[model samples]
Target: MTREKSQSIASQKLQQKVKGPVAQELKEMVPNRKSHQREPRSKDAASNSPVQASVQSIITQIQNGKPNVSGSKETPEDLSFVMSSIFPKETGSVDTSNLKMKPLDYERPDVPRLSFGLERVLFNPGVYHLRDPRSRVYNFDPYLGAIMPVSEFDFDALKAYITSSKDETLAGIARAEKKKYIGSSSSMTSVLSHFHYLLSNWRGVDTRMMSQNFPDHMRSFTRLLRSPAAMFLRYQNGSYAIDADKEFDSANILMNLGKSMEKLLTLPKEDFERYRRTHENKISAEEEQAIPEAYHYSTMGDFLMRSQLDAYDPRLPGTGMFDLKTRAVVSIRMDARNFEHGLGYEIRHVQGGYESYEREYYDMIRAAFLKYSLQVRIGRMDGIFVAFHNIERIFGFQYVSLPEMDQALHGQTDTSLGDAEFRLSIGLWNKILDKVTAKFPKRSIRLHFETRDAQTPFMYIFAEPVTNDEIEYIQTKNQAEIDAYQRRILNLEPKDGNDDLDETPASPEKPAANSQPTAEQNAQPDAQAAYDSSAPPDESFLAELEAEEADLFKGKEIMAMTLVVKNLVNGSPVDRPMVFRADDKWTVEYELSELQGKQVSRLYNACQTRREKALSGRGEDEADAASNVYIRRLRDLAMKGRAYRAKQDDFDSKHGTVVLDEDV
Candidate 1:
């Protein structure tokens, strides 16, 4: 096929795929139904009908060579794209067997006594009462029999009752059992089926009763059996209540109750036995003696259990004690702001306005402790133990220094103490200390001071023994402050010296202030005396120097001087043999020479005149031109003398220079 035809066929196939079987079905279903319907359709229905029409139009456009009717430009589907679209690997399948299968080797143990004192009082009150009634007086009601012992008794009987009522409970049990297996299914269909079965079969009363009555031994097992099914059902239906009107089947409930008892059963029997042994003798003695008005009964089992969980040491090997944290509200306050007094007034106002019941409780306890101890070492003492009853979350006890605690307690809201932030702060402190040490290498006895957050009642304070480097840095900072202050002072000071000079008097009587003496008076005294004592020359010396200067320019021509030189040399000449005077240094005169030597004499005279004028600060340009002309005449004579010799050398020696050979 031709390329165009091939492309067209591919486009047709793409249009068919993009249109999709679902879309075609929707179109076919709607078109005939719409024709038969005489009733007016809602806006939503009417709007949906055109969407299929638009898809069809786009399909037609793709089939023909036309603009896409559907606004979107759809690409043709290749085989790889089709495979990926149909069979997405990431979320396509899940191995549910691993998720649903219970751990095979974990056997349910017989329930033991509840070990925690508080938990026993709340969850197993019957055990607490049976063990010691006198310790259970607060808010007590005799009619509402203790829940633990009663539940335990009923739990055993309920199981027996369930085994006997097999026919009545079969449907519920079968459904529950099927739910358990179905919970293991990987397909969405199986999961949905299991969920529906759970909703139809699950009995809330049975579940709740089992949970209430379940001993510690059975708790894990009960949760293991029932939790997944309940969760799956709740997720599907979006609610906990199913079959609200019907009573829960007792058989399945008893089975769940039996399962929950597993946790209590798993507790070490030796621990309970030890408690029983330790307390039996004491109880008997108390009974034999006159009964006291009040008594406190404690158990070794409870004590050991608590100590096992709560005891932690920083030095403990492999404990990872520092990493463990109990979730608790941590209050942080800026003690530095407090120390600054009114400087941070806005922050202070905020701190004053904010209050929490927890803070109040903590404060009360702290005050009571202080009152009892006189001086409490807060850092050494474990702060508090907070327990989350509804959840398994636990918090550890910690205490911070007084100042740190004060800072934390005064200013801010509660925030979690992040391990990362604490570690970062420590690292920063170490780096700062290192830098300080490096800066002051010579200082052996250095003390460093730093500020850090206190954990308990979170606060900040000056931590001490600062290094020499730290002190020097602070000193440098202070010096900068001082320099700035000095500069400001300097700028503010008046410009006294210059201003005073401007205001001074300028009288002639003040020796013509700022003016220099005339040249004759300022001349050296010795030179001046010599000049005064000696009589002036009879003009002969001056005439001789002038004649000598003229002889120097005798051969020079006047017209040879270019217009540039004329303008630069003499603008106008005086017709005179110009005489120049010098003080004991020299003298010169240039006059007309004999008439036969007029040209040479005139040129020489002109040159000398120009020279003398220049020396006496006249005709500067003329003097420069005369000097240049003299130098050029000398250069020309030298060049002419060398030309013949140069030519001879070039011809004979094959070199540039030629020397003239005189008649030797």
Candidate 2:
């Protein structure tokens, strides 16, 4: 048999022999490593025991596809459990008296701080408000159709409610995963925002956790060395760039599941924006209202920080805000995406479930707390409520305060505030970032981050060149600035110095009504609108998907299509290309009411031409997005883009194109 086939079979047998949550970590590994090369073994490298040798034997068999294997049916008990499981899970509330203590008050190095009384420095604002500089990126209203008061937090009730809808939620997530939720998918709305965490982790890697925080400052890289090494990346667009390698993201699944749980666990109090929406949108006020947006923004130096609160619990003292988290019982392995029948992918009861039967305290400390702590502190929230589940059932829920999380990660030798160590890490990370940027400003670069089991403290970072895009991936305050840089660097005039779609302005028409329209009517703009990145897709066009795309989509259930259309205009245009369902066809909303009919006809003709061109230009490889499934999201987007182009063309045609500071 081939080496790859042998490796797959051997790995499968080994995982099958393991039970409980021990196999969870085995599912996700660092990419491109011979093993967990990203985290080198500093402590156990010199020691060799039977357990180590036996595990090595298994690895060797898998790697070389040897004739005999440790995990073969003849030697089933060759290895009892992965060594990490020695701690075992004795579930229930964990005792924390042994953990070190420190006061919660500390100033955030990034945000402005306020001091109260003698030493209490509140780094996170009691209330959050800051200018958001991103466009194309969209905001969404929170879902409040089933929020309950914080005082009424009944684990049993939550378990009952969530468990009932578990199947539907998992199924929805499965379908979403299958579709890979591209283009205008709600998952894409705050896409850049999600990268901050991973970025911080990359920056914060040092020896306080291993001294002045250098590679050789003091000692142990043990903790970081023990971390899962599967995360790898390539940077782009002034932020952590997206990669196709991250096709099946468990983190996203957790985020979605967590959001659903938050809606269920939250208090029904209407947020300020939702109250405003009720007053403004007459239809929304008269009908079921769209929930207000739920997120807080703050700036730390030149970087942007956004904290998405899961829920606000007044019942909790102080900040009262708390995050809801879903800890999956186990990660679904690549070989078996059988989410439906998988042993660990289902939901359970709050009382006697998988959690009760397993030990999670050490697991929480070693595996989850740092990230959980970072998130809690980012919002300066009171704490987090965690739901442990095996997907088939609900195990239970537990709350860990910021202080508790701090103690677990930092321990009792209090430095300056409980967050002193973290602050230092941030400073050092920034320094490293500054050096890198200084060396390669305004250029696209590849960062090869990985661990090497071949050496001690296996972390390695390789900086190399990549074919540059128009815009740099360095830090910027907002999307507009990023756009500005692109405009300055890129020539609008085509290679032959001729304008293909020369930008111009059409004759001015009467202004659109100042009154707001329904969410469906004007998805993104009050004047020239486009589809909100977060707007519910116009899936009424799904029938066209089956007809125009592929036979595989024939008779399949209606699902979200994965097509993305970029913003076509760059200057003084507030009415972006928002996609909306207008009668039988999707149209961009024209904020200028008097011009809607003419605008619609022009865009319709433009879109038709673009669609024909896009269809004719398709290639075999780029055609199927989901399995053998094909979609017109690309063609539809091209049509939408052409419609946008027509808008720009009308303008340039009426008023000859001019290049000015703001004329992009």
lDDT of the candidates, in the order given: 0.22, 0.30
lDDT of 2 at 329: 46
Q: Can you give the lDDT of residue 624 in candidate 1?
A: 35
Model 2, 335-375: lDDT tens digits are: 11222222333222122212221223334554456566655
Model 1 per-residue lDDT tens digits across residues 1-664:
7645654564444434434543443334332222455444554443342223233333333334342121012111211122112211111111111111111221222212222322222222111221122332322222121112212222211122121112223223323333211111111111122121111122111112122322222111111111111111111111110110011011111222223232222224342222232333322323323321111111110010000112223332232111111111111111111111111111001011112223222332222211111111101222222221001111111222222232232111111111111122222222332333333332321221111000000001111222334323322422433333333222334444433211212212322222222222233443232222223223464345346534533443211110000000022221111121111111111110011222333222322222222222211112232245533343343344346435533764563222122121
> Model 2 — TM-score against the truth?
0.33
Best by lDDT: 2
Q: Candidate 2 — number of clashing residue pairs?
A: 37
TM-score for candidate 1, please give it: 0.15
RMSD after Cα superposition, model 1: 54.7
Question: How many clashing pairs per prediction, in order?
Answer: 34, 37
